[model samples]
Target: MALSEQGRHALRHPPRWHWLLLLLILPIVAVSLLFEGWTTHEVDGARTRRACTSPIPRSADNGAPVLRVTGAGAETVQMPLRTAALTFDGGPDPVWTPRILDLLRARHAHATFFLYGTQAARHPDLVRRIHDEGHEIGSYTYTGGDLGSASAVRSQLELSLTQTALAGAASVNTRLLRLPHTTTADTMCGGEWSAARRASDDGYLLVAATARSRKPPLGVVRQYSHSALGYQEATKLLDDPEVGRFTTVTSGLGRPSLTAPASLLQRLQGNALIWTQSLGHRFARSMTWALGIAGGLGILRLVLLACLARVHVRRQRRHRSGAPWLREVNDPVTVLVPAHNEEAGVEATLRSLLASTHRDLQIIVIDDGSTDRTAEIARGVGDPRVTVVQQPNSGKPGALGTGLSYARCDIIVMIDADTVFEPDALHRLIQPLADPTIGAVSGNTKVGNRSRLLGRWQHLEYVLGFNLDRRMFEVLECMPTVPGAIGAFRRDALTAIGGISDDTLAEDTDLTMALWRVGRRVVYEERAVAWTEVPSTFSQLWRQRYRWCYGTLQSMWKHRHAVFEVGPAGRFGRRGLTYLALFQIVLPLFAPVVDVFALYGVCFGDTGQAVGVWLAFLAVQLVTAAYALRLDHERLRDLWALPLQLFVYRQLLYLVVIQSVVTALLGTRLKWHRMHRSGTANQHLLREPAPQPSGLASK
Candidate 1:
């Protein structure tokens, strides 16, 4: 195509990809949360935190526990006088570290506390408390891992991360080090000795406990876990007669402070890490709870629909047999078809109406300024009962008003030009109106071109979402809409509402709400079936749903005052409108939480739990879909597409809803999108068997 044609095509299909970008927010946050979870979470085994009793080489000082080894030579020192340097190893634990600090505070003694970085980040207060009391801090390799067993990279990360954690907690970096899973200089042997030499090369004073058999008067460096047993042993050592004084390693050795001030840049980075860890934890925790609520709400909706459908079937059957209000309906009904460039399926729609089992009909086709053969096609259909009325392009509501003026019968039926009714659909549809109280009846709308995957997904939605939902709505007497594909309305009710209107894009929904507000009843007739041509392409489906969603929002807002009215209108407002807001509007807006958290669980949480919950939700949906199919007399084979729909088609629908909501909030007008029909309305009509007569059996 030329550049001009490309430009025209671009204008025709304006970029809508940007609108769906909101859906990416959840996944991005989930990924960041998973990353934080991975980096911050550490699980050290029991053996890694245990004290090693291995023997050391004969080069270093036999009694001293502080070593500064360089090259092939090693040097060691002990505190002069009969004094011992008190040191606590493994952690500045939230529980035991605070208790140990209290014990030291009571005795007026100072000790070095080796902090596990993971614990330090979580309990920074404890690290600060250890430093603020004129004490010392040292690295226990973040998670208390045995450096002898760690790789070179692991060893470096363990030490550096501990430094960062200390920097964030107390704004200082420590050179004093205590290797976990070991006690004295004698135990720092083999690989432990190698790791010790590497640490000494980096200027870390390898601190260890005095030999087990040695006395504290010989200047001991204590080793202890931030645990109950360690607290007990440290208390005993503090009161020991062999120990003259309890002082920090630097103080006992008469050297400068072991901890140096951290740079501003390192402090900022450490603080950022702490902030992100906290954020990720809170976000994941909230998402989990919210996903559970969503799951529960979804299950509640399905359960209610299933139970209410049963009640509806029983009530309808009971009315048919014994209720005096219900009588056989043989009244003449007028059918209105609003056409706007629907040339593809106009003839099929007309012929289907003519072939209806209820033969006494007046069919009027209103041409809404179509720049196509829509008007000519209706006129060409040679039927005495068919009438074609031409009008200017004033939109769908204007065309419906024109057709309603031409309708001569007391009962009126409205349908789309791309819909074909079943032979007995019109008869069964009007039968519900025999009660005189029911002002409108909704018919089952099925997808005609259901051979493709997209069509199959829509077919499932019609059965479960629209048809099953209508059953519950009818039982509750809060039916929100009688779809335009097939619906019957009392002439008086239509006139009272000023006939079909352009007040909202969903004229059908607007009209139905008007009926409810006027003390008139609306109901669903599942036996009344109509096959309508649905959009075959994704672009067409998006545009079509965008209009429907936006229009429904408008109708809801327009009739929002009904909640304050009396009788039927209040019932619908409280029940129907509230239901739509919670389930349709609000729930859909938060539906992405399910997918986002499910991904997070799989990435950083329990895979089985996530998969189990997802599968459980899917199983519930499948069971509900099966029941809906049974009610509609549809085969179960179509359910194969239901699972796939959750991944792709369902996501598209929610995105359209979100975009439509944003557009509605902005008060932007949405004109009707003229769908490209394939004229396949009659294909399903011929291929599928006539719907079997439904009974009041427990479907």
Candidate 2:
């Protein structure tokens, strides 16, 4: 079976030209149709009309002046009409429809009301009244079918037309159409050219909603402070007479010119890649675009994030540099430790609590009827400062609640039995509670033994994620959670919020919000660090994080009423709630898709050189990790793991998020699953187990 060296060489080293040939021919082959001279004029499935070489000039009558403007890569014009048309959609309801008709009639206007088929069928008298009043009655749609798909758009359009024709003989020749919800382009209007051609072919002219379109529920349109600048620009454009020419609302009236470039961009163009690509085209383009845009956006984003990280580091440094917070709290504190099946670590945790530099701390251990000798070990700690309470297992929240009820101090600190606190952790944790305005303080949690790759990753997460970001949230007075692992609270603050509820999975987040509602200040103390066991196996990590995410969502749902409150925090509460939704929920859901598109750009888009895109994206991830590492003092080599982590590992988060969301929607329960720990920080510590001395052995 031995082959000659020459034969082996021939098999191993093939010609490089084969690779070069593919690289040269792909782009030209892919975009050949776009280069074809054929100009698509109309769409068949959806009613659409492309801006095809400007419509033929129509005669102006009834003392109407022709208005026109062209500048800055755009053109606008207005035509006159003998009659004004107003369209009202989405009701025959008592709340809105009748009032809308009175308003239109007051303006001496004739409107074309597009009724929902179901609502119209139910309100036959209302439909007749619209026709009876000389207003042109129409249909919104039969079932709110999207006007993006050819068949769906055609069917919906015809159904609406049929319903309108039934209302009156004059309505049979109606050509005006509107899309439901307006955010239909990416999903239904895949190819603009094709959709336009289809709609025009069906003798329909698409009408776009203007800024004056129906406001969202509760007049919240005015409350959209996040995009206020953009809205203000849009609002100003709505008032301009020439801007009305490009707008459907003033198509027949002479109006002011449109100003905002962004408004124009959104109205005129659709994302060709997102909407019109075949699966093959998508696969080829996804990498190129994903790597390019994500690379660019991710770079600027990381730069800003790095600055924030710096701010966090500086704050932590200042806190550590100045007098420690714990020096102020001289009163004896009640430290509550909730233990369940924790015989392995409960003793060590108790020992650490007894060793606290603050001599005024008393430890309260609640042993929730563990199957093991957890209660006996806790009692055997023999510290006069410790009080052991035994109760049947009712979960961690229930156990914590029971201990809290019996706590004798104004300041109460909750620490997990598995967590070994730093000598100063308890002192530093309670320092913030001394401030009359402060309600709670959260301690930083670090990984006890980060030897495995998974553990190291978790370590990185704690340093950069849990520790750093939380400081920023605290500065904004919107700290999302005071972690159960090592958190201290003012007893009055807890009592004001009616104590922690065990209904939701994440009692910590729920409690945090309750504190905020009462206007209690929560602070993060970096010096108050505890080393605790983290999930070592991938599956354990998945389950732990899934519960965390699900619990977060559950708590959010349970406390949604606090979002717009004029409570103690007021504006801070509103902003904090907005940040929670934007970053935690929305960004996690969208970031994966954004990454996919960046990859598409790297593989197929016009990102100059392919290697350039690759390098840019690599630089962003590296820069982000570098700053993140610097802020937390993690190893620099951790940055190198980002690409691999993103490719092979980060996607697991998306799956967990999806699963958690689905489970929540379906009303599923998930109890916290603890991971196994080696019970030692180093391999040498594991050489011999801790000696079972006689004083700690008896129940």
Candidate 1 yields a Cα-based lDDT of 0.82
lDDT tens per residue, model 1, 1-699: 111111111123434554557646665576657645554442232225334445455667476788887775578887766787777876667788889889999999898887778677767788888888989888888766678777788788788888888888889899999887777776777677778888988889988887767775677777777899999998988889877888888888899988999999879877875666666767777877888888899999999999998898888777767862367788999999999998889999999899999999999999999999999999999998999999998877788899998889999999999998888999989988887788999998988888899999999999999999999999898999999899999999898877876777778888999999998999998888888999899999998898788778888888898989889999999999999999989888877666776776776666787789889889999999999898888889999999899999998888877887776665455567768987875776678755665654565
lDDT of 2 by residue, 1-699 (tens): 111111111122223443355345445433422211110111122334223333222221111212121121112222332222334555566555665556546545455555555455445466666666666543455444444443644654445433443233222223444444442222213343244335445544444332334232211011111123433443443343432122123334433211111223322221221122233344434544544554555465456556655676666556547764435776778999988888878888888788778888778899887888889998898888899999997877888899998888998998888888767778777877767888999987877666667766776667656775676676667787888788999999999988867756677887888788888888887667676877767888886887678778877776676777875456446766766675566555555555545444444344466557567667766766666555444457755556666665667776566566655554544555555544654232244332221111011
Candidate number achieving the greatest TM-score relative to the actual structure = 1
TM-score of 2: 0.56
The collision pairs in model 1 are: 117-142
lDDT of each: 0.82, 0.57
Our model 2 lands, by Cα RMSD against the true structure, at 20.7
